[model samples]
Target: MGKMIVRLWRRGFLSALNRGGDPHISDEDLTARARHLAARRHLVAEDGQTELTHALATGLHAATELLEEAGLSRRDARDRAGVAFLKSGQNLARWSMRLWLWVTPDPVGHAKAGNKLAERARMAWGSGLTVHQENGPDHATLMVTECVFVDYFWDAGRSDLTPILCAWDAQWMEIVNASDRPVSISRSGTLAQGCEACDFCFKRKAKLVYSAPFWDRLRGPGHGHG
Candidate 1:
């Protein structure tokens, strides 16, 4: 409805694109959309950090309005908008290029893939993190919760495994617990496809994986950070 509100909506839309959005759009086009949304929100600049200043309450209201306009019920709009912002903020971090990548079949595969990633990450970044499974409320998406807080940076990748990233037959539920503080939890796993069929392909993408401390320090409320 208002210009600022529209900008907020655009930011959410850009986030979806960053998280392996529709395959139809080219990377260049999606980058343009992301920049445009950021510009409208006064979040982009020639130099310096792009920060989100609006109160959470304001963002919540705007997102609710937009979602309802799109035909979702009032309650659904609020929930969806809330999660969208949480995820979009993570997208912003992704665009900022402050995080690294890690891939494995799922949390269960953590024992196998995580230890290796942790070892290399610790050697490279100074800390190691563990993956913890987290369950969501009934209405939210199902996922495996991995905690990257002990010595990490952040995670901004997609949970989908098909067209983008191609991690696995995984579904993810991103958990955003704090606004004033930095936090993100992304979920992924294959519902229809098991790890056997998708394991090899997933490991290949794991090449982009990051060091463990890269994620640990950035993940929790208790962890110390720079």
Candidate 2:
């Protein structure tokens, strides 16, 4: 799983970097280098969580270093690298959103799916991740009051890196919005934005009614009410 992640990340990162005219090594070569860095930093643990999290951090950190060598500032390096990383994972991220749309098929069910994924994250990272969940018949909100990656990058004096992590969550929300599905997801804040928690707000889109006024009829079907 660790190596698999590195491969995907390198694919995205390399693609983005190359598009900017900053050449990158092949994915196979980059992946090998990143895995070595993770191992050297003692970030790979037997249970695999360390590799799952820190190993990617290790790769991103390397990307920053490489970009810095190409004349980018530390902040610029981090922002660019983070963007590349997010770009790399978009397809995989869409799968879950698509799955939820297929499985839940309603606003309430969508909210439940979001709640469950938050709970799953809580279990995956233990203290590193924290989820404060709220669910209703038509809406659900999952807030992350604490996050390991936010704390980690901040402690490393690179709080800028945290937003890249936040963008991953953003991708999921964006996917739902792009779909014609009646359910939509949103967020008002993230720990990266100095909020107390990152909010994942999912609500059912209002369905259009045919029996409404003529003006409403011209407007046709819509996401009902927000």
Candidate 3:
């Protein structure tokens, strides 16, 4: 992650922590915990990762450690980090989604572009992104057919943390499912969740309603964004 992304993620993480954190765990303590995690290079996933994915792996691994050190259960730490990561990336994710939607308005076209994007991403991540069944004008599925992190986390005995990386897509998917967009992305299963793949199902809405633009609708929850 870049300095800016880390800063944003940190901000969001703190906010998420404060909302329902243990009464004993102060904001300063969590901030310091995150800072300590960020201070060093924590190597969790070594191979089959891009610089970005490597950062995600190490960051998740580090957060797992820090949270554990802070007396959180493994599940709570990952879930909490997942939520914070989702909040942190919402802005850019929405904008990229808006731009992608603009370029490929129709669901089928957008699905094709998603395929290309996955292909390009594979060059970096060392795993394939499978965009399946673009034949449907309004429905498609995108998934990590082979996620590199599977092995890394499994080896580290921290596969539970893999879902935190999956959080990167949660915001964009939410945008797709938002009212303004003509499409809907749904994925109830994930590789980290013990599913065969991290599936993101894209479906076009049967009808379009223009109450408020999705961007404007997004502006509220998107506020105080990290």
lDDT of 3 at 39: 48
Best by TM-score: 2
lDDT of 2: 0.68
Return the top candidate by lDDT.
2
**Residue range 76-105, candidate 1, lDDT tens digits:** 654554455455555444433232233212
Q: Count the backbone clashes (under 3 Å) in each candidate.
A: 22, 4, 0
What would the TM-scores of all predictions be?
A: 0.25, 0.75, 0.63
lDDT on C-alpha atoms for all candidate structures = 0.33, 0.68, 0.59
Model 3 residue runs over 4 Å out of place are: 1-49, 123-134, 207-226
Tens digits of lDDT, candidate 3, 1-226: 3445545555665566446565334446654554454344354433444434545554556555666677888788777666655665677788977777654545545565647545545555654234333335556666666675665577667787766667677777777666454677778788777787776677766554422343445567554112
lDDT of 2 by residue, 94-145 (tens): 8966776654536456447647757766655655667878887778787788
In terms of lDDT, the poorest run of 10 residues in model 3 is 126-135
Report the Cα lDDT for residue 131, model 2.
84
RMSD of each: 17.4, 5.9, 8.0
Q: Rank the candidates by lDDT, best first.
A: 2, 3, 1
Q: What residue runs in model 1 are displaced by over 4 Å at the alpha carbon?
A: 1-51, 55-57, 92-226
On a 0 to 1 TM-score scale, where does candidate 1 land against the true structure?
Answer: 0.25
Q: After superposition, how far is residue 34 of candidate 3 from its true place, in Å?
A: 11
